[model samples]
Target: MGIKEQIYNRSPLFLQHLFTTLYGYQLHRERYGPVYQERFRMLLEREHTTIDVKAEQLDRLNDFLHFCTEHSPYYRQLFASHGIRLPLTDLSELKHIPVLSKEILRTHMENIQTDIAAPIIGKTGGTTGTSLQVRYTIPDMQIRMAHLDYFKATHGVYRGMRRISFTAQDLVPERQQVDVYWRMNRAANQLLFTVKRLSPRTMAAYLEAIERFQPETIDGLPSAMIELARFAKREGIRLTCQPIAIFPTAERIDAEERQVIEEVFHGPVFDQYASSEGAPIVSECRFGQKHLHHEMGIIELDTDGEILVTSFDTHGTPLIRYRVGDRMTLSQRICSCGHPGPIIESIDGRGRAFIQKPDGQKIFEAQLASLVKHLPNSIERIQYVQMTTDSVSIYYVPDAERFSQSDERLLMERLYRLFGRDIHLDVQAVSYIDAEESGKILLVKSSLTG
Candidate 1:
């Protein structure tokens, strides 16, 4: 546990609420107080009928059009260079503008930022490793959180509710600190279970902490939840305490994984399609129907099948027609859930899957990932790719003086234990790994079909 755990966790309930109120005030207040919460309530009560949602989105889209050209350096120069007029009248007019790729964002980061306030820079710890960084205004960050909170509330989660998150935070920075794996975010009533120290050795402590906290809701990556499930099953342990819901985010969840998760926890898993770059794309309803948040932006599927997003919600960085690198199969049929939005039939998110052997043997990606948990703290990125049925490649980028040949050999030895002795492995320490042009990471690439 950390110092915040010692200080905040020991505080009384009313005192904790006082801290939460103060922090919420500081975080949400921009031009005035109460607008954030008021907006949250408005969003909560309003039933987003498709037509109303579209009209509202278009209004925000129009406002953003004029706002971006005036305030954003990149969009301003791009429009000026192309001789495109300010304040487009119709959505059809936007067709002339090219889609904003991740390459553009990475190259012209400062240019895309709105000159409103000092921005908070955040890094995305995705499957590609911690390569993608984004900037958000403080108000925009608060709004995003509120937006997520409201969505969670739709399915019965609320503020100050007991929740536990299993995410990719460096909680126990030192590997030797075995006793400390989770810390209490007392103000928010959240228990954070870090992913780095989540192997079988630390599984017991994690379960104990989960039981101790007795969370009302479970949130975070599905990969981590599945990790907990696997650990519990292997050790002949079961989670007696059940949460109201399992909220999965920041990663993809397949049918098999989702089914196993539902069985393990005996709770409904509500999945959401979101990004760190201020795009709240789609969400799953209580009836397991996925609906597009039309109020969020104008989401379109291009000819190349890339999901292009124009987020009105992004004030810090107005991403107009940004090519967010996700491919999805969309549905047009009206949902049985009575939600008035188009369904996201499927999403191919940037998540790694398990590799399967020819003779019916399969390896869980999370299990392999736990092996790499012992890697040095200086390691910035890690990726393991399957080239052939018998061949594997490990690609990693390390901070200077952080990784060595000994580390590579050690990882290979660990892989050999899982894979047979005849398995071919190539481990390389590179300066950087390549991503899709739109900056999406493909964690695992296999030549052989599953």
Candidate 2:
């Protein structure tokens, strides 16, 4: 290991950012605490209240420009390629800026990362089944810590309250050390629950941990959260500690799933948008306003609906205009929360879809899941593939005992009700559905595309 990485691994989270000029920890007790309470109160205000969100966005953009040019070799070349100099006065032509793809960013690691006292490694989870190792400087690690603090504070789960985080790393083999370190760093107010072994029995153990720990909040991927909630509900376990919030990140939180989480937690559920390639982009307020964390970076929705992010926090690898594969709507409407950051109405998806057409009319990817949910005791895990325009293949992962002819027939009936008999139904019992490297089960993929 390099001296930089060795130093970073041993360094405390608080000191990590202190060494970085580009990074600053969000002062939760000093500044963010009062602002957080005030923002929650403002959320009670009517949506019509005008908020000056653009100014904050501009401020973030300025910071991003400075951070990129000063520290990131990738951004320096990118700007030079466009024949642009520093002190960019206008973002009007931001669409013309280069979009940083994951592939491109990976190839330029040496220039992308900063030299720190310690080395930080870059990693991708199994959600996409793509495990990537990237390196970080001590400063880069601090930026992440600061971002996490900002996100948690925004949701009122800042200090004094314990957080029980359900992480996908709990299930993976290589991430054990990271899980251990994260747990130790936040030991005073955090409990780490691994989802790697989320069988019925293990899930029961997780439930018991939550009951015993009685954390002030629950944070993890939406998929993991949903699974835990389902297991808890089935077991008749009441997680009624009245946690300040239930925070979901690392995956899309659909309306139905959000409702389920809200029902399980009996409190407000906040959705946090973050990625391996970018800083925390947006977070939802109690009023359901997804306030873009404009303080950290500049983000835009591209013409193709992909989220483009640029962060001032970039020291290791600078991302000027990075295209995050996810989809979202950039709202012009003011959030009832008085935060000056613009709101995102919804995150549509990661562009994964299963095209289904019954009578020449296209069926959305979501409709496949809808069909399965109506089936009698159908397993919630399902995937659909469109072999041809007319033929559709379905893969359903069901519990061992429940995978029977009767269950198949009931599920087919539901599909027939929606798409008629011309569509194909292929159901099977697999030991498990594969999750993306990020540990999110896609549930569906489409060969047929527009």
Candidate 3:
């Protein structure tokens, strides 16, 4: 642990709250300054306009392309090699540029970025055990924050409103035996709850804390919220706190989980799709439709539904044609909510969650699922655990009547064909597959550090 964390752990509960509030104040200043205010107002005003969305987007895209060509050495060299001229008249000209993969970003991050004074650094959650660090300019950060705040404001959630957050952040000390699993951020009026060590035995404390605080909004990881909601439902306890809305981040929420959350909390769930790497946002409207904010970025989908984003806000580390490793299906049906942006049918979580082979190839989640797709109602759920490059353990929940020995043999044959002779596949039938330490259920869990 760092020295500051050690000091925080050693301090009394009251002091911890004070420290959290002080830190929150610093963040508030950084995120909610005059730039943020101006950007937020612009966003709110833009929502009401029937302006030519595509034309404006193309203009912004051209400007951003010009900036990247001027500032970033990687993009300048790459574009020059492709004979791509800047200030393209049409958006279709983007096809001339090469797609920037995650591997490219990992290898050439420094070259991808423009040198800026004291840029804000953010890191990905490293769900695949390969974390990515991204830098943002102050105005970029402010604009991103403005977009988020404006989205929430549309749902009747605002800054300084009483809110409860359950996230992967470790707020409570591991060794501390106190029942308090939360810290206060008075500057943002947020009660931050730790997602660690949550169980039925300790859930009452969380509920009690929520009841006492009576927050207007709830935000954080969907898995954590689902756990709390499931526990409450199982215990036949209804929360007294009626939040304006529940905002889920980091992880995707299925229909069942969303229903449970809304049922327990007595609020609507506004889902958002964005990345820690500062990808452009696709926020759920109050009408339950997901809209891509055209002002923020351009999203293009490959044949496999993988999205390549060119975010205008990523000036510090301009992400032009960045393959973000997530999949989504775009919708042709216009949303009745009257938002003048493209609608997304569904956000199909992360497409890049994969198990690495011994020879450094990867078998992603979609490809792995194809092995059992031919089976008829046999498998309920499946998970792959990779501790080493050469071997993988598959835990599967099977239907008793349908999952025959022949089906297992067929699965084994398919696995061998996909993995080749060098790999060892250990497929086991299990009643249940466990979630990760953060309570999120991952299809692929690899301990082979990237």
Candidate 4:
């Protein structure tokens, strides 16, 4: 066996991946740093090249799927059971393969592979239930990182620039070793904020952190960022540190939330979609096109309103036609930026999160955010649960003071006007509302069928 293979197999799967990261750090310093800068320069050039040429991306999908079918035991068994095989020349042929769900991963957890040689590992956090751990190889992880760089460069965010990452990280007991990553990222000139402590007081602290740090970019789940924006606006506090760009991840960036963020930051907002199971897959450009990161994998938009993704970056526990619980659509036209890649008009969160109407006036959970402006009281956080087409339960987590009887009546009246009196409004109080494990707040949760 080759020396590289020997060393890789000897190391623990997770540790081998860590060493790979160390190697990536060197690669970043010696090669990627310069190359990526040039790539960024080209990306922002007057005449930009198409990121992944259509012909080449088509070819890569065949190789990627075939690799998964061969190396990933879980996918191999799934394909065999479902009468599926890989190596299709055309991307359109992916339809023959059924979409795999998070439930399948949870059930067949052991069948997922761990590449001891060229070792790798990963985790699918907060999707179906608890976060399920997955593994990946060195090549897989590097490809994913490269794709991130490609997307960041495409949107004018580079490595050296200061970035404030507002994500979930615990302070006491030091939850994960990865918490160090956030700090290391900060020391490397990026500031990181923990949404684990995102209260009104904590948000004010976040504002102070931004002012002191002066981050060039802010990246996090859109919900937390929007809440901060709303807090800033209402409290008459303006953060002097207006980042050049704000990249919202982990959740759907609805129009109402977008408007508020843009107003607060006084800049354009870029949205990207990623999941615990999938690599950072798609990014929206300034022209508002949600272009798939073709280099990482082929992301398919099935007519069933599901996103089926197979990544070139998941060699450890490779996913083939993996259903990532989101309902997204491909854009019908080329972007105004002249990029040939597909545009994502919006992400409608998860299936369980969508609200269906018999009258066909389907509503998304995020539509509840619009009611905030319409509410009499300064609504801090609200969770709406649609039990049926005609019934929904509204749970309001009011601000500092308790909701008065008159305030409750007015809020109820407005909600009735919107969803009708048929919907049951159940008012409840909580210390604070939180997003799901993926760090996404469900503005509306439907008790009905997912």
Candidate 5:
């Protein structure tokens, strides 16, 4: 290793900003440009922000249709075959455009190309052990960040703050023994930490880095935060530093996990709902209201509860009426936060976590998390591996020294209560649960083709 690897002196921070300045121009600069800022500021400033939702949706929907018909051969052929006309005046008329699926995109990827110059290929984090590749342009990147900037404001996270985040970056080498686990991004004041090496052994090194940096906000997935809290609590390590707020994304965080993280850091965990397809979907406010970013996309729910999104401003890879494979419930009540927008009642993580019962009934993984919620706060990470149709294994990480036998029995009982007599449940308490290769933590995985 290097001698000055973990040291974040002025020279290192300056060199880091150079890369961040060029690379993050679209994320930081384009999103905060005068034009983008004006529109974003107006959205926040408008007191009586009552606009015709159906009309705006129809207009944006038609605009997307017209663009697709002109540039994308796949969309053009589909629209022509289905007799879809431009200038849609009614929102219900969007039904004519068939829902675009990921399989269809893969099959006709070239046909969907808009002839943009040297487009970038975007990959989904593949939380379910499978990765998806999609083509995007510069404009698509801008719209994604603009949407992020809009919602981040709701949680009091402005640009250029000292935001410490744990993402899929490979800043730290896997085997290196370093004093710090984080690297400084001087341009944005972001302390980037690698989530690859947060085992029980090196968890103390991570705490040392955080204690030194003293970041303003903590932005990362819930799995990372929960595991950190588990190690701290288990070791009886008291953190004298706390962030202003915590922002979690890209995973399903149950109420219990959020409470533990909040207690450990002494901050509120503001969770967000988004997809890897460059669509910013939902966010929470101070009043715990989940607001749908209507200005970002026109969101709709399928009969099966799949979230269909149309990116109104994404010109690079326009996801018009795209089935994002996630479910959401719409709320009729307005937000008490005084933000005039549509609200989402709830957002179920991904469609992969629906575990089946013995009676052929399916239950969300969040429902199973409730069983352990009544248990002690020692449970940190939870994962279920369905070995077969009649056999299942659950692996969990504990904050205490070890999992007690009674705790194991209670966990088994919960599984039996969930899957019933037809299935065999095996509970194991381990040091840690592995994240996906793409660095996403999946709550459940099924190997059986049932």
Candidate 6:
């Protein structure tokens, strides 16, 4: 840890809160400056426009491409090698350029980044075990934050509101003896909850803190929210605090999880699709429709449901035709929300989260989740770990009263049918399944190397 962390670990809870507030103030200054204000104003004005969005997209795409060719060495050579010139009249011509993969970005990061001064650095959550560091210009970061804040504002959440965030941020020290697993960010008017110490034992404390805080907005990993919701329901602990909105981030939430969170929090759950890699925003509207922010970037869907994004905001690290390794189904039907952007039917998270069959076929996370969906609350949580092609280990937390031997048999039978008799299924009931280092639960963890 750093010097600050060393001090924070030794200090008392009140001092830690002071440190967090000080840090939050610093971040607030960085994130919500004049540039942020300007971008936010522009976004608010553009939210309900009838102007030609397609024409504006093309114009922005040309400008961004021109900037990349002029500043970024990697894109300049790649575009030149593909015989692509600046100012492409149509978006279809972008197909000439190759799709940038995660591995390619990691290998060519130095060349890919432009020589900008004082760029903000960010790291990916590394769910696939390959974390990457990305850079963003100040203006780019401001615009991204503005877009996120604007999304929250539309959902009845605004700045200075008391918000509770359950994320992987290391706010609580491991050696702390107190029952407090949270820190107060006075500057941001936010309560930061650590997902590390969350369990049946410490859940009451978390709930008590949240009730006392009375947060207007709850945002963070959906898995953490599900844990709290499941615990609250099982313990019959009804909270009097009703948030204005619950925004799930950093993880994909299915319909069942969404319903549980909404019921527990007594608020609407609005899902969003964005990445730490500075990808454009795809936020859910009030009508439960996911709309792509056309001004932010362009999304091109592949036949296999993979998406290639060209983010206009990633000027510091230009991501043109970047394969972000997430799948989504595009909708053809118009939304009743009156947002003039394309609709995303569903976000199938992390193409890497899959099980490899003996015949080299892949069963994705969403498909694997369906196997346990009919368990009727008997299974609290489940995880699939594939170590080799022939074997898979299933770890699940089952409610003792509800989960019977027949439930285990039914789950095993379903797995056997899905894997065929060739693969080995090792299912075990456990107290809990550990989350990833980032504190986000991965439904499927594959150890096989490609």
User: Which predicted model would earn the best lDDT?
Assistant: 6
lDDT of all predictions:
0.68, 0.58, 0.78, 0.61, 0.66, 0.80
lDDT of 4 by residue, 149-266 (tens): 6676666777778777765432212223232222324223555565544445456766666667777788876666787889899999887776778887665667888999888877
Per-model RMSD to reference: 7.4, 14.2, 12.3, 14.3, 12.8, 12.3
TM-score for all predictions? 0.76, 0.62, 0.79, 0.65, 0.72, 0.79
Count of clashing pairs, candidate 1: 0
What are the per-residue Cα lDDT tens digits for candidate 1 across 1-450?
A: 347644555665445446545554454454223545765777767755435665566677778788888889888888888887856666767777778976566556667888887466554434434334566766666566666777788898887788888865544434233466766666577777776556556677887788777888998867767867777777877776677888887667788888877777777899888776677657888888888767677877888887888887677777878877677888888888777777888887555575555443445444444455445234566677886777778787765654676766766655665555556777787888787686755556666633
Candidate 5 lDDT over 193-251, as tens digits, reads: 76644556667888777878787788865666777887788888778766778988777
Supply candidate 6's per-residue lDDT for 223. Answer: 67
Residue-level lDDT tens digits of model 3 in 1-450: 358978998998899999999999998878988889998999887776687888998899999988888889998999899999878888888877899876577667779988665368776532332235678888888888999998899999998899998854557765678899899999999999876545566788998899899989999866667778888998988888899999988676788989999999889999998876778988999889999878899899976667899899998878888877677888788889888766898876654456777665555543454445445346556778899888999887776666788878776765675666677888888987787686545768788744
Q: lDDT of candidate 5 vs native?
A: 0.66
Which structure is stronger by TM-score: 2 or 3?
A: 3
Candidate 6 C-alpha error for residue 421, in Å: 36
**Can you list the residue pairs that collide in candidate 1?**
none
**Residue 378 shift from truth in candidate 2, angstroms:** 38
Q: List the residue pairs that clash in candidate 3.
A: none
Alpha-carbon runs more than 4 Å astray in model 3: 350-450
* Cα distance off (Å), candidate 4, residue 60: 1.1
Question: Which candidate model has the greater lDDT, 3 or 4?
Answer: 3
- Residues 1-450 of candidate 6: C-alpha lDDT, one tens digit per residue: 358767988898899999999999988877888889998998888767686878888899999999999899999999889889879888888777899986678667889989776367776633432336688887888888899999999998999999999865657766677899998899999999976556567888998998899889999867667878888999998988889999988677778889999998888999888887888999999999999888899999876667899999998889998987777888888898788777899887643356777765455543465555445445666788998999999887776666888878777865675566667888887887787686656767788742
